[model samples]
Target: MTMTDSAPVAVTEAAAGPEPAGAARWVTTNDCRIVGRAFMAVSLVLGVGAAAVGVLTRVERLDPSAPDQILGGLNSWFQMWTLYRAAFVLLVVLPLFLGLAMAVVPGKLGADNLAFPRAAQASFWAWLIGSLIVVVSVFAGGGWGAMDGVTAAERDAMTLTLLGAGLVIVALLSGAVNLATTVISLRPAGMSLLQVPLFAWSMLVSAVVWLFTLPVAAANIVVVYADLRGRDPVAFGLPESPGIWGQLDWLVEQPAVYALAVPVLGIAGEIVPDRLGIRLDRRGAAASIIGLFGLLAVGGWSQDYFTAPADHRDELLYVGVGVAAVVVVLAFCGALADAARRGSVRLQEMPSSALAGSALAVVLLAGATFFGALRVIKPFELLERSTTTGVFNAVVAAALIGTAAGVWHWWPEILSRPPSESRGRLAVLLLLAGGVLLAASDVIAGFLGAGDRPFVGDYDSGAVGGLNAVAVAGSVLLVLGLIAAAAAVFETMRPDRPDGPGAGDAAAAGLLRGAGS
Candidate 1:
């Protein structure tokens, strides 16, 4: 296939800016790898901090604890919980995914540099500065739970914080355009649409979604910012409406948020073939699934709309909703299953395979649970009751798997070396185990009540204290897993580390060898 000519890029910095002098290169450099690494580094630091706070929040839920002493009283407790989630979604989830894309997508398109390297850098800085502002705001108790108390200063800070969020999305918007243009215009010889890497294809689709939905997100943020500024409540949609694409989770069930999981599905698709050293079982089918996912993503946003499930079902919304859910869940699961079945998949030196395998398991289980719920109750109620958090956590786990595994799989290609294999595997397993335990606890909570990651008072922990304890343990394990994963990756990037495995690495390897294949 011949490549088509794309319109001229603006190239704003190509000849316009003063060159950086001396040590500023490392920080201000537009090299995709450097920028990507910076993004992940900031995310890692914040994720570790969030984990500590999150564990404390979860621990507070244990029975017989003094309410005042639960993570430094109620205010701080709420702050910690709010910050924990913000860090997870905005910092950890987003930056990690963006970093991987910036680092990997260029090579996927057979290009030497991103189409807008400087724009990628801008995306990094904008997101960083904006994220920092929001982090400050949330930590200052400018979050959802902070509304009960009215302080002029706090409210103003939160308004800035929401604007910061809008700015962050704007930065991401720039990245989406940069990446999409790069992939579209820079493919190497004979590369056509179907011939592109699954990750690259998924990123393109995700970028397109961002283009349409981000403006809506920004408008919603504007309305919220207006409300915070004491303007009339610009209630754009009813509280019962589905979240706008991925960001809308509060009002309706959160399958929309799982839209982020589509690219993750593509990442896993790429990993399976590389690990197995074979061709993908159904390349066209996988591509078709991705397209189906994209359509379902936007179309299914308000599956139940402003009304109840029964009303939607009467309008035939139930069938469409079911189809969308099944596509999102079954499409990727089926692809992975097909690959594994056709290939001699095994645990090799890299444990990322294990991580990807675990991811597929959780996604399948989560999807099956939804289908089972469909038989007994309305899909909306099923998700609203308790299954939402459990399923969301599982899908998040799968996304984590996709991100970590993609990094691990492409590390040698990108970094020209391998990381601590044994340590990485341990981290992957810990995360998977943590995800399973946490999902189970959420399922138990579903029998108790409904909401997304509510704190001590959100649900009746008195009746389900044991289940809550399991969840606490799960949180601890999950955080430790993230710490381990971060350490392995960062250790590889250190300046003077030896190429070979160390004593701890050797011992871990031997332990694994002795345990089994």
Candidate 2:
């Protein structure tokens, strides 16, 4: 008999001897994998939308004087805000849901269902509602991606507060679910923390980070909302004050970047070893974890420099630089190189996911180095002339590209079928070409030029010209590649029936029999 045919018989045989009264309970775990898949699908859509907005922003800056065509009079400033808001929702909200569901699901966690299944259901519903509220806030009578005109300032204020609170609750739920599942459900009799998969470990670390950071973010949002309504939120203090609340606001904002990136970093680490077919090195993994935590702490402290006294600011800058160089830069690079080498040595066949994730990791690491330098050595220089704008753009581009590549690498396994080889080749070509164009643009814009007074101009001239061209081209390529790959995967994974009794009917009957047994 074929494997599909035998699968039904095996399930039926297992079910024929069941005895426990509640053993056959049709629990919420009925569709964990499907739920996980749907979560990932939504995440991809949001990610692509956010990236598209970013590309447009770059294009608008490249040639500001051009007729307001793209995005309907969408200037760079407005696009920046849109990108920021979109990114916050995509990066913060979507990932939280995906990560939580993945953690609590049956196979990953080995749970019959989520620890608090009702809470799990509630979490998903609450997150959906909260996400809609935040997204609607963007388009509530304002222009596309506009936020300034929502007339319900009080309502908007309340919604924002509710949204943040909801996010915190979601984060807490993720932490609880992941922790309980990892400790109680996912761990087989022999599995220990060290034996757990790297991806699971990464999820665990990210959960801890969320546990600590989300409350701060939620509290600050509440305080900000209160202050907006002419209420005295002196408990949190003003931005310049010395109170813990002020410190908390600064604390929440700084680590927010890492809060998003760390999970991605963990995913990269896990994928690299698996794709390469190498055993993950425990020491290297531990070092990477430590480095991530150290950087998170230092980065959190550095946000105070924005309003801090000169001496305190200087000290924080030095600390930040040290952490970046010693902890984040050197440590992560070392771990990545070690993992890559091990994988290359062990695995004869390298999948696209492995290659793409490795490359993207390098790009992000490089961007992080640049960001560190910008923040520490010449903060005033970049801020005064807006020279840092290019750096910011570069960082965002690298991040989005890296994220896309990582997602593509894992798409086949996640979707249960390989994407079309033709589309895969096209994606590779588009990404390479786009990278080349963006590089050329950077060089032409005099990014490396040495001058006391930088000549930053409008999008009509200089680097903006080249940047715009590259941005538009890259965006088109990226969207096309993503859509093609998604279509191919969906097509390939569609159900196929054999010339015999349908598998679903057989499987369903077998399951019922097993339950009755």
Off by over 4 Å in 1: 1-23, 63-68, 72-76, 145-147, 230-253, 299-319, 346-380, 413-416, 450-463, 495-517
List model 2 lDDT by residue over 1-517, tens digit each. Answer: 6455467768865985653333232123333444445444555555556556656655655545542456554322352434344343444333533533353334444554444555544454455555555445443422122222223443343435345444635644453464445445556677676455544555565556555655555555565556534544343423222232233333322234344444445555655666556655765555356446434633443445336454343565553653464355455556667877866643554356435644564455455445435544443432222233333333333444444444445443244443454555555455444444443344334343312112223224554455557656765664564455446545544442454232243345335333432
Candidate 1: residue 227 lDDT (0-100): 62
* Clash pairs detected, candidate 1: 243-248
Model 2 bad stretches (over 4 Å): 1-31, 63-80, 83-114, 141-185, 189-191, 229-255, 282-314, 317-330, 339-351, 383-413, 421-461, 472-478, 481-517
Native-to-model Cα distance after best TM-score fit, residue 284 in candidate 1, in Å: 1.0
lDDT of 1 by residue, 1-517 (tens): 9885653453655555776755596567877877777777777777777777767877876743453465555555655655665566666666777788888888778797789999899888898898888788866746543413435665566677677778887887888798788778887878887778988888888778656666665766776676666643244321121121223333123434455565776777777766656778778788877766655454334434335444443334545554556655576677677777787756564445434544554374445336424522544445444455565556556566666676666664334235666766777777777767777776666767634445433556565677778878888887887888788878765433355543234345335433432
What's each prediction's clash count? 1, 5
**lDDT minimum window of 10 residues, candidate 2:** 450-459
Which candidate tops TM-score?
1
